[model samples]
Target: MNSLNSPWAAHFIQTGAGNNQSFEQAGALTLENIKTLFAECDKPYSGLPPSALKKAIYSSDLSQVQPLEKVIEQTNRLIAKNSIMVQHPHCIAHLHTPPLISSVMAEFYIAALNQSMDSWDQASSATFLEQFIVDWLVQTFSLGADADGVFTSGGTQSNLMGLLLARDWFANTHSQHNIQQDGLPEYGHKMRIICSDKSHFTVQKSASLMGLGERAVVCVKTNQQGQMDIDELQQTIEALTAQDLLPIAVVATAGTTDHGAIDDLHGIVTLCRQYGLWSHIDGAYGGALMLSEKHKYRLKGIESADSVSVDFHKLFYQTISCGALLVKDKSNFSSLLYHADYLNREGDELPNLVDKSIATTKRFDALKMFMTLKSVGAQTLGEMYDKLIELSAQVADSVKENDHFELCCEPLLSTVLFRLSSHYQGSLSSGEFNQLHQTLRLQLLTSGDAVIAETKVNGKLYLKFTLLNPCLTLSDFDSLFAKIESHAKLLTNKAL
Candidate 1:
């Protein structure tokens, strides 16, 4: 039977007719359910153990169909109730950011429209909107008139695209061979990509996926400040050449995960030019600094990079999974070009976004950034980021002053790495000291007092505070510290 005559007629969104009442009702209901759920949960998390949560989630019978209102209620009870509340002031664990209200509103429009970005016919206006945003990004980074970019899932996918283009470009320029058409060359095993030891793990992961194995990634050690040691980097590159290795590219990190150290971009780019290697700047975290007039100097020479990766979800306050990869030379994207008769025909004059991306059937993610830029404006976003950096510095100083905590180093962006003082450890062995920190973190999480992160630095445990929330103030952190101290004292007393 036709949908109009069937029982499901009310479920579909009807265009050209009056407003879809069902959609309006469902949207209002969902929003109310979410507000109620947030009001009931006071902590960043519900503090439910994995086993209990799993049992509660599976208790519902999925085979049974229910009305939209009932479905929303069940979802809140089972899923949203247990999910991490990233917007909470004390949820300072990862790079995740609380999405901006403007971007959140954009997400609703994005979902309702359901535009697929691969072809123009499926996303006519969306395709052009994405291009306009990309053009603006290219200009913001000073990537030249010939540059272009495409939105990606996040840093991982963007990094992969940079390396893929670098590999193909190197192969074609040097040996007149096309790696995409011919696969890895005979000397593929000798090809090497270089990055600092503090670079994201995605560098090695990309190398493995490219069929060069993990060994193809040559890591240069960092300096005392956690930045890539420029002198050591030069030595490493020279050593690789002496060993007859083919160094095709250098991935310079704009921000390290643990220390938030920004590498010397100009220094790295200079060396890359000297060696005739492709220079890629992985600015997934610190790229937002370009908006800050005060901190933009840290990203000097970024414009000279052959490619760059930026994530809006991190510091830009957009929703999750929104990032872009920009290339200095737009023609380099030819390596990823492919045609399909049904979707992106070769002779078609209309712009198809699939030609610039590794993904097809992509969501209209660019709309989120477009709306955010228009509503919030770039100047306000810059000031917000600057405030986060200032807060990190203040926290670091406070940690140094407290006898109970030991500051690892100064924060360059917004991450502070520190640990409990040795006096608090009471002559415990190295392993036990690390265990103490781990236990305290867990205790805080279980009590739902705070949600902090832990990482190892130089084989010693260090707690990390990734300050991404601009709304948070020093007073908020003071309270969080008091809870941490209480937890630590309880654990230490138990050990005694």
Candidate 2:
């Protein structure tokens, strides 16, 4: 049989060959299907219960081959329809951001090209483009002339890279021990990483993954504003020294998860320098502020960090799974460097990105940022983030003025933490109060009215509004607050 007559011929994307019309048809059909899906859903979520959603998705038959249209129709019915709408004004539950249109377009090209960033031969242009993006990021953050970076999956991977390098660098410098060639050194058990109590959980997770237990992370108490307490950090370091334990690195958070608090980077770096420790800044959320002329001062000392993690998916409004880990000295990447003779051959003049990355077959995610930067310049993106920050402050002020709500703290970035007031709580017990907040958040979500975040602060439950959408206005939030009030009343009446 002629290969062109086979059933599989039309399914694969082909270029510069016979009968390429299927590619165009498939692209059009898929895009139209997506547009229809978006237009059909009015709410941020379908409000489907978990079991029902699961069963509906699982019912699809993957055993049989289906036409593109049939598969897309099923996806619309079972999957896309029920997914959370991050672009919705009420959908401000997490660090998730609605991707920029430019980045979305770049995603299409990224997937279509299917370039393996590991080797120059597989992705000649892509490899160089990623290097350019990494170089630009290093320069933009003022990571010094000797600094370099590599894109990763997201914050978790980036944070791991930072901690991994810190551990290896410390081992090599202190005892002339090579962690890559050999296992962990004898003092590895005593090595410690210090961060604020409000730091992202990845810091502890990274330590455990690096063979150091969670106990290796000594969390200094945060201040009232949720910033890392500089004095407490110094005290903790001195105490660790007194105990003869080795403190390898200090992980400072630029924007905490719940409170959006940025630690005192300058103070933390100063302490790190005094104590002769490596400094890493986890700027996965607030790192975008470097582009903001108005708020860049918040991350003043980030440039001096021994390593830094920046996620483009958060405040930068890029697509998900886009992040970079930067190091002050390019030599730090030696910890993860390797020469795969078949891929990144030694003495090859061409650059192979996998040497600086933990991932080998990485997507061309750098193109998304590159396209976004080119289409909408950094200043515009910074202004969009600035608008969100301004909106968060407005929401905080409004919450303070409301009689039914209790404001937690002044938002340093775009997250507003608050809870129902005692007046609204009435005679409910401590447990009841916590349950009420939790129930209120769920009721709103399950009803598809809003998607607010719920978190615990000092053992007390609180509602969070991670205001990531710059297009949202005070009126939109006012409407959402009215819905929240109504939901709380309904839940409270039921409990009573």
Candidate 3:
């Protein structure tokens, strides 16, 4: 068999799979490729239907597939044909952003090496590297003395780890037995978790997975800006106590997903301490802001948390599928530890990561993060954080200055919510107002000139922009708003 004729071999040769490109050269290549793909970058949409797009991708018949060179051409065409460009400055939806270019190159190395940090024997050097990065993150956050953690897929997994640990800790302390072996029989069903209404939905999902019912997550109210109200939190805890429910943990969010609002961390920490509740800070979205000394103050008292969740992909400039759950005590892994003779033959073996994580085979995600921080230095990353926050403020200013849009909330971190201004403020029926907001969002998506986000607030439609790209400037917002306004006017015309 001619190896050159093998599709896999042909693909590798065609794409230079085994060849490494220097950072400078790769970056230039990426830029050139991007320019070539998006020839008319200013176009509003790709103008391709879902069926047509699927047909194009599925056109590749492996049984009679063309040479790998043709596949590369198709791949480039796919990139050029999509409107979902997170790297573009005008993409202002959700927490999406352009990851650092250097980290992207590091990701290539990680993928090629394919290090699985499941156990020491399988990934000795990779395991140690991951451990070192985790230790550094623990120290950086000042989690606690002898704190430990592991990299995860993302915020949802990290959040789940925190909840799982909290559940095990509560179980072990109350039951005087191992929950992993004995289950939650000793602790009973009185255990519950608590978070603010603005907290990520993952908290509730995590609770349900931890054997606590979805209703077990008590929702504390928040202030006007979406910051969790300390008074309401305390009252909720007290009410739960009166009902004889054990409050297992308090989950404080450093940045709520909707508006990037930082909770009253100092106050929340104090209350957690007073109540003897395990405190977990869901800083997955905002934890990277700790890199910036100027804005680190917003996360004051976060150091008091028993555990913290941080997503490197969110702002650490790492690619997607990178997050961490840091614990104050190294021994917290005891609850999750599992042993088997076949896999645990080495007496001096370092702990298997599967014992610590929810998954068995985990990617070497720490490589990208470690390389990114080392290559760019913490100072540069911090500066990038500051720049994005400042850029978000600039976006808000643009919104306020324009007669077409209004600022819905003060950006507590790097998110801005606003909506098109309308004189039809005369209380339209709720149904009518919601209908308008829905129409506005659909209009923007179909336009595709500028990507935006929408979320419901107190039954009102609100457009949102999550600015996490340092490369974007206020001028980007000018175009973003101009497109939004143009589309919104069309909606208004249809309504009339």
Candidate 4:
């Protein structure tokens, strides 16, 4: 037998290929196992450490069949042992939530089909489905008739695609497409991108990857609430033009990472139109909130953007790696088109995803969102956001009332920043306040009872809570704080 052909793979496959009775027995056994596992994991929600996983029972040789089987069993045991239970009411760390159950089941079929989405010939209906979804999203956001876009791995990739498209669009119009093939030659002026200071660092990184140095991303000052200051932005643009620099694009953040603060899209859009600069919205975190009838006004001018990036995984209750970029003009995608004699037709009538994206192979991310949308509709998702916003307001009010914690900033979207008030004194130096903030976050994570995020506000570190889950309540934070208090005491004792 070839050493590469391991019997362990055969054994695993054989286990999956089962009779009706075998499935019944397996189902019964799995339920029993899950129940027992949940019981052991229920109390304390989580712990510092459970126990080191049992050592591998297999030898190094690939030909060792029985020992390899034992190793597989041990690995499965460990995977089934612990559950983060993000769906449970207790979880409140990163931006996460209980995904739609239907999408979870659809993923199995998507995986089995293994369709290549680069070309219509490769995927047929799958390719059309992806295009239709992108089209639908454009319509939903009210992007103009010129709107078009492509799916990406996530926000980072989506941001990169936006910058790449803007570069191609600008250069093509300015120099008759010289940069695409000849590269930047006889460049008339240095290019620059304007974005809020609160914008994600990914914007700067994307610029760097696109041959635009990090210095190309100019950070416009934001207001106290983290919203971009329109006046400051206008002044910056004017200053750049005065220096004979080419202003390529203005990136407006729909929901900032730390605070969920949405910049004034209307103001940014007006400025972009007035200056003839490309306008792109990095809405990967908050763009989906457009579904909310109540909170939709927060992102009023998003429909006017030249391009928009949205992440379905963040607030749509979908699995990760589902992100999309929307462009107001489909022709802009032509700038990314490539031809391979073996892969694509010379004049393909059908929409090829690869023509519009930086990636050659794309996942069926639309299926999950499609299943979720069809089953429940967008309005339900909107209601979920409304509920979360209301819950966050309640949490903020509670934080304000509590003498122990201080609300560092008002609730923006679904995140709140607060820190311990116990450390506050009649007069304390900024250095001392910063130390207290660091100590508080360290205490929470080390305790493992609850995990809270932290961020800086006006140079002071403050604990941040991102309320992505609609099901969580203020009572949940009450429970979270009780654990924090206990952990803080333990940490303080150790420090003493």
What TM-score would candidate 4 get against the native? 0.88
Q: What is the lDDT of residue 97 in candidate 1?
A: 96
TM of each candidate vs. truth: 0.98, 0.98, 0.91, 0.88
Write candidate 4's Cα lDDT for 302-348 as tens digits.
Answer: 99998899988888888877889998888888777778775677876
Candidates ranked by lDDT:
1, 2, 3, 4
What lDDT is reached at residue 182 by model 2? 95
Clashing pairs in 3: none
Error of 1 at 349 (Å): 1.6
Which scores greater on TM-score, model 1 or model 4? 1
Residue 480 in model 2: lDDT: 86
What do the candidate models score in CA lDDT, each in turn? 0.91, 0.90, 0.79, 0.78
lDDT of 3 by residue, 1-496 (tens): 9565565542242344443233335446655666786565664346465577778778766787664345555666774656576776767777866778777787877776777778778888888888889988988888776789988998899889888888888777765667789777644578889999999999999988888878889998888788888998999889999998899899999889998988988898889889878888999889887899899988998887888899988888778878898998878877877776655555754757777877888898888888887789888889988998888887788888988777888798899988767653335566676677677766566556666788877767788888888877777777777777777677666666
**Per-residue lDDT tens digits of candidate 2, residues 1-496?**
9667888888777655667787887788888988887777678888998788888778767898887778877777778888899988889899999999999999999988999989899998998899999999999999899999999999999999999999998998899999999989988999999999999999999999999999999999987678998888999999998999999999999999989999999889988888889999999999999999999998999999999999999988889879999999999898788877798776889888888888988989999999999999999999998899998999999999998899988999999999998876778898899999998998889878889899888988999999888889999989889999999888887877
User: For candidate 1, which ten residues in a row score worst on lDDT?
Assistant: 1-10
Off by over 4 Å in 3: 1-35, 38-40, 43-45, 55-63, 424-428
- TM-score preference between candidates 2 and 4, better one: 2
